[model samples]
Target: MKKDIFIPKVENVYIAVVNEYNEIYNSQDWNAYIINNKDVDLEMVLIVTSGYNEGKITSTFRKKLERLPAKNYAKIELMQEELFALNNTFKVSFFEGNTMYDKTFLFRKNTINLKALQPIPLMDVKGVLVK
Candidate 1:
């Protein structure tokens, strides 16, 4: 057997939106998910950054991922409509084993455009406990 070998990469992590009722959100109650498709478990910090030169849009939640198991996901309670007005990106710092990884993924501009976004699935939905 191949043992399902997979090389863990921090860049593979991505964001998604899931509604509170496990259904399509009605302009609110949408959550932001960080899906991890790696071979190792990770703990991470997620911060949303946006806005103009002077006034910056900072995430008050300061979402944290205590444990993102291999091939699993965790999410934060972030509304989709709230981020559509500004350009948003996620600055993620995660630790896998003894090594640290950092990267940023564009959300609002490329992915989360409420004005033009339609239903699309990027990855499989696998749930994990998130702190």
Candidate 2:
């Protein structure tokens, strides 16, 4: 019975960390975003994020969205520079049509930096993408 379960693969959905100048604060800030590159919309989207290291752990953050349109993206949270030293993780769950999909994206310790940035899908700026 365990082998009879059919789990669909999640495709084109990603979590990205972007560093951009904050016009209001007049400083650069690191922000997390959820990208939906699929042709269909995602409903009841949920994301839980946290950072951890050998002996340090950050607070868990939970965010939810009613819907995420296709080929679009939405900002999830602001990431403090201090969190960069630890391994950051994002747990995503959402519904496509009548099926549910889940995926985990992670950024290893000390990896969220400008040097690791690359062009992100559906976004004009470059940023680090979680694999």
Candidate 3:
């Protein structure tokens, strides 16, 4: 008897949102305004849910980011330099407050310790964590 092999589709481009706490967010929440635009043409936008700041998510700029597409849609851009340079384990920092935000992140042995980001920053929102 012969068996068939299964292959998974490759995701060429990925829109990574620099969210906090590794939570999942729906793009529609912030991108609804641009959905009806006539000049938006982006595949996906990862809403990196940066931890909240003053009751709002930090750097939650899906509106601006989604408007970058030609069809008036924007997508999260991921550079090879950043992704490729990252090891199996690494830390990412994200800001939480205003006026020169500061925070710390560390990854080791393919594991991320969430506690390090207690007092997050205002920028540098890293993408969601995937195991």
Best by lDDT: 2
lDDT of each: 0.57, 0.95, 0.26
Where does model 3 exceed 4 Å of error? Answer: 12-110, 114-124
**Candidate 1, residues 4-98: lDDT per residue as tens digits?**
85434566666665544444544435566776766777876555544322355654456776788888766656665556556555567788777
Winner of 2 and 3 under lDDT:
2
lDDT of 2 by residue, 1-131 (tens): 98999988899999999999999989999999999999999999999999999999999999999999999999999999999999999999999999999998999989999899999999999999974
Q: Candidate 2 local accuracy as lDDT? A: 0.95
Task: Spell out the clash pairs found in candidate 1.
Answer: none
Residue 117, model 3: lDDT of 25
With a 3 Å backbone cut-off (N, CA, C), the pairs that clash in candidate 2 are none
Model 2: weakest 10-residue lDDT segment is 122-131
TM-score of model number 2: 0.96
Consecutive 10-residue window with the lowest summed lDDT within model 3: 28-37
